[model samples]
Structure formats: structure tokens, C-alpha cells
Target: MKEDTPPPSSPPPLPVFKMPRVHKQEYWSFVRLVAPSTEMPPGQTAWKTTDAELAYCLKCKTTFKYRSGSSASIRKHMNHEHPHELGSVGREAAVKRMKNALASKRKSSAVIFSPTKRTKKINPAEEEMATRALIEWIAKCLRPLSIVEDEELRFFITLVQTMHGIYELPSRRTITERMQAHAQQLRSLLKEKNAEEVDFYSLTTDMWTSRTTDSYIALTIHFMTDFFELRSYTLEVASFCGKHTEVRIRRKLRDLMYTWG
Candidate 1:
């Protein structure tokens, strides 16, 4: 009775593709997760600055690269290549979610933005006044000039003041120039007052070395005005590199006196 052949075996079942489960914002339903090894060509390693993952489109089987936690590139691919599948309603919803997510992130980072509010226009005069006031405050308080670039101060101003959109902070160079102008104005005023009101003047000098071993000498002049009001002004602060000899000090004072005259 001959060899009875076994029944023809059925072919193996096709692999079932499972869609990856990810954050709702990632919109993973339209794509399949791909293993990096399988996604890359043989003998080539996947290189990325961020933690990268592969995305395979369910509809087109196209591969896209994206950061591990975000499917923004995949979403972009879908919007560009398969817009018909992602209907107008779906596209709008996706855009809205993206915007809301970005706004949330900025808020968490201490930045506030108002999209619908109409901001008041700041006039040039107002802008100039604010800048002058800021400069004066920085000078009078001996605060660092870099404070104008502080992020927290910027956020605070943006959150509270409506003109933050139009008002730019003065740069370090601008501040330095303004400070020089203010110094010159004050010096001119002092010279005029001294010429009009003073009979005699007394002067004092001090020299010291700072922690960094740099030496400095300060000269201050004192006098009584016509109204008996006493005033003092620091006329010079010279950086001295050599030994602080008495002769050098007298020469420096004499040079300063001649310059002032």
C-alpha cells in the first residue's frame, strides 16, 4: 500500500503588525515602531544627537526618524504625504494640541504669552524715559550692568509690563557710553559750582591693593560752598602699577590738579 504522504502543510501565518502605544500627543496610531538594528543597513550604526527611534508608516510603510519620546516627525510625514488620511478636522486638532503643548512648556519655563490680547503701543518718549530710569537705577545702586540681560528680570517685565514687546534693554556698550555722558555732565556742573562758590579746597588721597593684587589710588576733593554747605567729590582713581612712592603720589596729584584746571 505505498507510502502515504502526509497532508500538505499550510504556509506560516503572516506577521501581525502591532501599532505602538505612546503618549496621546505623539499620535502613534498612524505608525509602527521599528527596531533600530533592522531599520539601519547592515554594518552601519544609527547615529543621532538625541535618543532616536524609528517610525514606520502603517499606510505607506515609509520610515521616518524622530526623538524617542516625540513623534513630531512622524506627524509631519503624515501631514505631508498622507493628508487625505489625516482629514482637515484631524489636522486642525493636531495643530491645536501642538500649540497648547508648546504653550504649556513655555509656561513651565516661566515664560508667559498672550495671543489674543492687544498690547498698548509704547511711544518713543516713554521708551527713552524708561531706559534712562533703568540706567540711573543701575548706576546709583552699583548693580551689575549685566542685570539688563537677566532672564528672570525679562520674564518679570514681560509678565507685568505691557511695553515689554516694544521696549528693548540697553546693551552693555550703550550703558557704558551713557554712564560716561552722565559723568561728564556731573563734572561740568561741579566745575561751574566750584568756580562760582568756593574760596579754598582741601584734598585727600588713599591707596590700596585689591584681592587680585592690583593697586589703586583715589583722590577726593573737599570744599565749603558760599552757603557753608560742605561737599566732596572723588576726582580720580588711577591704577598704579609701580611702588607707591611719596614723589610718585605728589606727581600724580599735581598732574590731576593741572588736568582739572
Candidate 2:
């Protein structure tokens, strides 16, 4: 036979391709209160009413201030105080009205800032401080300004918000809820620990009405600790409604004791 055929050549090895790895960038996601969509949904326009940007609370029958003068404020108040009212005559309709008013300013053609992936997380300490500030404003200072719209308060809050990246301030409703919640928490703590520390405690009770005719009854307890340190602490501050008589007062005191007992 003639020369053997050329040595069989190995086929070319298959080329291997590697998949590219995708690096995901995480951004702090939140629902932005932008100008509402182009139209208002049904039954939303009536929520547009505001007195100095404060919405009227149907439950309280009073105008309460909110930061943004937007429907979100009324909606929030409804959610916390009147959880029963939502979806039926919802504030979405009113919010749509407000957003529509502001639509001209928030143009799609306006210079848009690109979103950054490196978002600053809200500081809890700063938020708590803000909450305390809100309580001071309403309770101590007697200022019922909206958290967003108050000129003087915003100056102070803006400093904290910008410095701490806490864009959201405490809602007025949040302030009310937190005040009650914190009070309840302290009351529970005192109930659990007071008996363990004192053998006996004497109580003092008093009732008074302010210029606004809001009645208040305060109770205090005085006691000596095991270490012989004298201590006087407030036991309760309750609203005294209706007539104040010996029979009624005694019954109320008994009810109060039953509450903490």
C-alpha cells in the first residue's frame, strides 16, 4: 500500500466562554410624595381643603397641621386615629387634588438629579430626638405647627434632617401615639418594680382645671426604700370627667386603684 494516510489530526478544542458577573447596587427605596398622576381618582377632590395647610380632622372636628399641606397628612391622621375611615371616602382623592395643584412646578422637563446608590440610612437616635422635639413643641411649648410647614421649627429640623439623613420627621399623629405609648411603657415598668423596692407607699391625690376647662387629677405616692432613701413619685395623671363629688371621687379613686392593682 502506498504511504499511509496522514495521521489523523485532533479536532480543535471547543472554546469556553465565561459568564460576566453582575454587581447589583442597592438604593434606599421609599415611596416619594411626588405630584400625583395627571388626574384625581373619584371622591378625592374634597380632601383639598386646608387651613394654613392643616387638614381638618373629622373625628376631632378640628384643623390639625401637617408638614406638606398634602393629602398624605390627612390620610396619615385618618390611618392612626380613624382606622375605620380609610378606603371609604379615602384621602387619595384629596391628595390627588393637591398634587395636581403642584404639578406645574414638578415638571418632567425640569432638571432631574440622578439617584445615587450610596444613600444615607436614617439615624434612630436623631429620629427619637426629633420625636422629643415634636412633643416639646406641642405639649411643652403649645405650638401646633405642622412638622413640614413650620418656618422656625423647620430651620432646626432641617439642620438635623440634613446632617443625620433623616428626611422624614415625626408625624403629628406619630407624636400623639408615641407619647401615649411611652407613658404606658413607663407605667408598666413602675408597676412591675415599685412593690419590690418599697414595703409601703402613701398616696396624695388632687384635681384641678386649667383655663381651658380641661380637668386633670393627679396622684402621687411617697415611700421609703429598703435603703431608707425617701422617694416621692407620681402614680397617675388622669382626666376627671363629669361632676366632682365625694361619692364620684371615691369611686374614681377606687377605679384607678383597680387599674394599677
Candidate 3:
């Protein structure tokens, strides 16, 4: 009995099993990687004419076939005809996709080879010098192109080159065009901010006489918080009555206050 008890036999060893090896493809299949489209809805084509029998552009009044031509042409038609119906992001994405596709196709098919030599390491000082020189040149060109003010343009270009490491600046024309576009965007943003009674708080006034003996009137808005910290915007011309009469100035101030409120 004791001998049998002694052999009360060790419990069977737990079975060891190997986990199934997951292939990269199988793993990726389970992962949702594609970012949600902010431009257009899925299963829907942008700028495609509605179910109406006749495709008429409300903007340009031009008629075209449904889903015909390039997306750009379609978007252009919509912009000219149905500008109000098109969303901003949708139009932008369509134009960008078209431009990118065209550019990618036109790009030279030459094979680019990275330098094999270790001696071609980038020198930080040289890179910085090159970046600064390029930034200055960009600033000078931006003013005449009416893109942005010299200082602001320089700052922006410098920031882009320094932060993003875009060593090769685009053509001057392209830079100017882009800057002009961004300036327009800035103006639109300013308009939106002005439209919304956001952070506006106080008023700044300045009076000056022009060459034509006209008393030019200028006023600025000051925005402040409960912390008494002054905000950054310069004085914006609130009124230009041509004469700085007290009554006119007061009326203009009142109107501005009303609008701001």
C-alpha cells in the first residue's frame, strides 16, 4: 500500500502548446489603417452632377457629361456654376489630387541614387548659412510679388527650412504664388475672426492728415482677457470718415462697438 501510495503518480505535466504564428498580411488585415476621408464621403463621387437628366453647372451655366473629363475640369465647372454647394475641403482635395497626379506623371523617370561616399555628411553650419541666405532671398521676392511683408515672409521661410528641413527651395515663382495664396488665406481667417465676437475688448485711436488736406481717421481694436494680458494685433482702421470730427469719430466708435458686441 505504501509503495503504491508513493507512486501516487506525479500529476501529468501541463500540455505545452505553441501559439499560431501570425503573418504580416494577416495581422494587417485586422488593423484599420486607412485614415477617414475628411474631403469626400465614401461610395460617393465629388462634383458629379445630380440625378437630373440635364447636367447644368449652376456657376458657369455650362453643361457637361456626368463624370466626364478630369476631376479638375469637373470641379472647375462646379466652382463656376455651383460654387455655393461645394464644400471647401472637397474642392481643395479634388484640386490637390488632380495636380499631384499630373505632377507625378510628368516627373522625370530617371532613377535617383543616394551618394555612397561617407564624406558627404551634412555640415550643420553650412546648412544653416544656406538656409538663411535662401530665406532672405525669399523675403525680398515676396514683397514685390505682393505675397507677404518682407519680415513675415522671411520668418515663415526660415521656419519652414529650419523645422521641416526642406533644403531645396522651390522656384521663386512658385514660392511667390504660394505666399500670395497663404496671404489670401490669412485675410479670410482675419475676416472670420472679425465676424465672430471672439476676444475683442478695447479700442485704440489715431488721427492723421493726408496730402489732400483730408483728415484721415484710423482706429484700432484691442482685445484683452481677465488676466490683463495685452493681445498681439496691431491697430486696425475702424473708420475713415475723411474728417476727424468728434461726432463722426463717436458715431464710428459706436458702430464698431455695436459690431464687436
Best model per TM-score: 2
Clashing pairs in 1: none
lDDT of each residue in 1-261, candidate 1, tens digit only? 897643323211222233444445335556655553425555756533232355566666566565765667877887788764465336557767755665564565463447554334589999999899999999999999999999778755654442325667789999899999877766666676667677799989898999999998888889987788889999878788788888988888788777677
**Using lDDT as the measure, which candidate wins?**
1
Candidate 2 residues 1-261, lDDT tens each? 696533213211221111123121011011112222344558665222221233333244434444443445545656676553343233444545545544543443264646662434469999799878878878777766564576666545434533436566699999899999878766766776675576688988999998999898888888987788889878888999888989989988888888878
- Candidate 3 lDDT, tens digit per residue, 1-261? 554522212321222111123222211121111112334446765323222222333233334432322234444555554443344444465656655654453352233535562224358999999868767876876635444457666545544533435466799999999988876665555556655644556667676766776665555666754587666454344436555678888887777556434
Error of 1 at 151 (Å): 24
Candidate 3: residue pairs that collide: 58-81, 59-80, 59-81, 59-82, 60-80, 60-81
Q: Measured by TM-score, how close is model 1 to the native structure?
A: 0.37
In Å, residue 56's CA in model 3 sits off its true spot by 33
- What TM-score would each prediction reach against the true structure? 0.37, 0.38, 0.30
From the highest lDDT down, the ranking of the candidates is 1, 2, 3
The Cα local distance difference test for each model comes to: 0.66, 0.56, 0.47
